[model samples]
Target: MNTESVDAFQARVAKHAALADPARLRIVDLLTLGDFSPTELQAELGMPSNLLSHHLRTLEGAGLATRHRSEADRRRSYIRLAAGALEGLAPGVEHGATRVLFVCTRNSARSQLAAALWQQVSEIPSTSAGTRPADRIAQGAIDVARRHGLGLADLPPRRLDQVAGVGDFVVTVCDNAHEELTILGGVHWSVPDPLRNNTEEAFEAAFTDISRRVNDLAPRVHAA
Candidate 1:
């Protein structure tokens, strides 16, 4: 190999070296599902706190993960898969057996963003609704969607009663909505309601989370 080519290969090797350990690989897998605080990671991985931090540091060096402090709780740091970190391993192809219905309390943010993200990532039909539809979608949700290259200019908050049986696959994005719509028989994300915080960052975080989960959930949603 030419000197330049050899250097490139070496760099590639170095980047992937961080993932050579099995524990790091598992950390990457968990981050794919959603962002987790160090405490949460320790509980999930049953690893020592200091060791988990070491793995996260390695991931950061390799550009495979990023960390952010929660705006509400600065003492907590959340670790998420970095931008494009999962592109090499993301799920492909939608399960077309059942249309997907995204649900939350207000349908102002989480469910709305989830459905928009699902549309961008999957071919299967998807939409959003709420337990108690807001009079209007949150402007922060709209702003964040636009920033993420999604348009929510016309999508409105829809009531759950109007869409209870609209789809065979129902994914609830809030704890309350999950309990209220238990008969829907799909997964519940337990995602926080961004409107309660009403910050640009909060809305962006909500969008990022819903987008990640929706992308991951698409491939496994085949109807029974």
Candidate 2:
């Protein structure tokens, strides 16, 4: 085999080897939906910190997971799957939802885009809201949406309490909203806040992340 093919084969072998342990496999599953701080992951898995660290190192070495410092909190770091690392991996369980509620600290960007994208792929009803509603949607978000053939200019930012109801499947699309809200049965997506940078590139990246997640989730969620 050629050198490039040998390297590709070795990488796949490393990934499978890393997931050989049940603990490491579980960590990948948890990170599939959202980014988690090591502490949060420890809490979820009830694993010792040292062991979790070992697992994280293994996943990183395998090119399956990566770390990012929190934009909201500088001291904290979160772990997430590498982009496209799970392309052919098994999907998570299917679920039922009367409605899908997308949430963020501000209803201006990630959540709004997610709700709109969900509408494109799923028959289930969806809406966007915020923990702390902004007076207006971000112009960056609006422009990105228009570029993607989705409309956000006419949508008003709503508070979570105002729009969310029982039977709604909640998806928190930002770190702040996920950490701030004590949501029952809510899924979290750690899409970075684009308003912090307010650049076209930042907004486009956020839109792409939310769009992929919404598409992945929409098919798994059925109307109840």
Q: Against the true structure, whose lDDT is highest? A: 2
On the 0 to 100 scale, the lDDT of residue 85 in model 2 is 80
Task: List TM-score per model, in order.
Answer: 0.60, 0.92
Tens-digit lDDT track of model 1 for 48-162: 9889889989988888888876543557566777767655665443444457888888888888888888878777778889988999888898899889779873867998778
Residue lDDT tens for model 2, 28-138: 887776678898889889989999999999999999999987766779888988887877784655678899999998898888888888888999999989999999889
Evaluate all candidate structures by whole-model CA lDDT and list the values in order: 0.74, 0.85
Model 1 RMSD in Å is: 5.8
